[model samples]
Structure formats: C-alpha cells, structure tokens
Target: MAGVSRTVACLRFGGDDLDPDEISSVLGREPTYARRKGDVWLTPKGLRRVAKSGIWILNTDDAEPGDLDQQVAALFSGLSEDFSIWRNFARLYGGDIYTGVFLSQSNEGLSISPLTLNSIGVRGLEFGLDIYSNTDDDQKGVSEVADETLD
Candidate 1:
C-alpha cells in the first residue's frame, strides 16, 4: 500500500488587527484545527490540502485605503520570509510543488495574486507577484518585482 505522507505548512496573517477565527473560516476549516505557531497558524492537513489546491485569502474588515496598504504589506512580508523556506522544505520532504497565493484589499477592490520566482540578469533572482483585482466590469492587475543576487 502507498503511504500517505502529510505535509505541514505555516500560514502567517500579518497586521495587528486580524482575527484567527476569520482566517480559519476563509480557509473553509474549523478554528480548532488551526494551532497558534508564533504569529501564524500551523496546520498539517490543511497545509497539505492547500498544497494540492491553490486557494488562499486575504482577510480584511473593510476595504479602506489603509486596510489595503496593510494587506499588501503583510503579503510582501510573508513572501519575503516564508515562501523560500516553504518551497525548500516541500522539495526536501518529497512533497509536491507548493505555490503561494496572496490576498488583499485594494483601492479597486479585493485582490488575489500568485507568487512566482524567476531568474533575471546573470545569476540573479527576480521575484514577481501578480495582483488581480476582483471586479467584474473594472478588471485590473498589478505586479510587484524584487530583484536580488547571491554573492
């Protein structure tokens, strides 16, 4: 019989004004299933499921300008710290390829984006995130780029 290996993942919701239960609800799971790990929640099963299905959310109370900034900032922070480690760990542990989703409130409306890594320049790395505005008539998108290199 094939063994079912579970992959663990840590979900970090930045900003000082986020409710744990709300985040859990966005994940379509119970709050009890989410355990407090530092500033984020660690869920083995949920993480595995998320790896299989690329779905994520950016929880916000209101779609205000400041709220949008906070959400975007939180996403950038998470990507900078968590994504690299998560990708490396997933590969090392023989897990499937893991992708990152960023959710946030924007001036246009709710936004969702996929985090992607690319190679730019000589031996340099470029991280690109595409932000899609969730609107029917006024569809809009944005991209944030970060370039770095290893010495």
Candidate 2:
C-alpha cells in the first residue's frame, strides 16, 4: 500500500449568530478566515456569494503535510486545553476539527492514534475526515519516494 500522501487539518466554529471576533477573543488567537452572517464573500474560483452563517477558521499552515495526528496536534498546540471552555464554545458555535487526507494510491490507508483521539475528545470537538484520491495514475509511484512516514 502506498499510504497517505498528505494531510491538512483545520479548526472551525460556525453558527447563525456566531461572531468571529467574540470567538477569537475567547480563543486568544486570530482566525485565518472569518465572516459574519449575510456578509459578502468571494470563492477561490472567483465566484461571489453571501455567507449563510458566521464562521471562524484556524488552519495549521505552519505544520507540514504529513501525519494527520501530528497536524491536528499542531492546530491545537497553543490553543486552550480546557474542556469546559471548548464545550462551551461548541455548545454555542458548533466547533469541529476537519481533516483532509490526500491518498497517493487507490489502496492507501492511515490510522489515528489513541492519544490524538483522547485529545480531541477532551476538547469536545467533533472529528471529521475527507479522503481525496489521485486521479492521475502516473504519479502513483511517486508517493513511494515522497511518503514522509517512510523517513
């Protein structure tokens, strides 16, 4: 098996009445992207639309694309570790950790560590995973050389 090629992790909080600034204040960190309900926003494809609800997103860009657990840990590194604070935030804004996994081959697979799961569970954050497969078969073999876990 080729295994996973890369992973990206991000923390998000969203709700109809959510205020990015308010959440930022409590988290003591700035958001990578944030918008209020009904605010004008533009898509990466250049499409323009209005936001349906307020959202605050914090991305782990500083972390290299590799282990999902390590990436998730990087996202939470400096953030509050208090369960009550996270639970309160989730109750009000519905927070979750979203992870995007890019597979190098059709049979690629990965697993999450129990320690990482425990960390997420204690924070009251919902965990989500999205897998993406490479459409081009030509690069499938490249993953063998590029897989960081092998190092």
43-88, model 2: which lDDT tens digit per residue?
Answer: 5457787887788888765222358788778878877767798888
| Collision pairs in model 1 | none
- Cα deviation at 98, candidate 2, in Å, is 0.4
Write one digit per residue (lDDT tens) for candidate 1, span 5-52.
Answer: 111112222223334465444334332122222333334234321222
Whole-model Cα lDDT per candidate?
0.27, 0.71
Where does candidate 2 have its weakest 10-residue lDDT segment?
141-150
Q: TM-scores, in order shown?
A: 0.21, 0.83
Clashing pairs in 2: none
Poorly placed runs, candidate 1 (over 4 Å): 1-58, 75-83, 86-151
| Clash count for each candidate, listed in order shown | 0, 0
- Highest lDDT among the candidates is held by which one? 2
Task: Write down the worst ten-residue block by lDDT for model 1.
Answer: 142-151
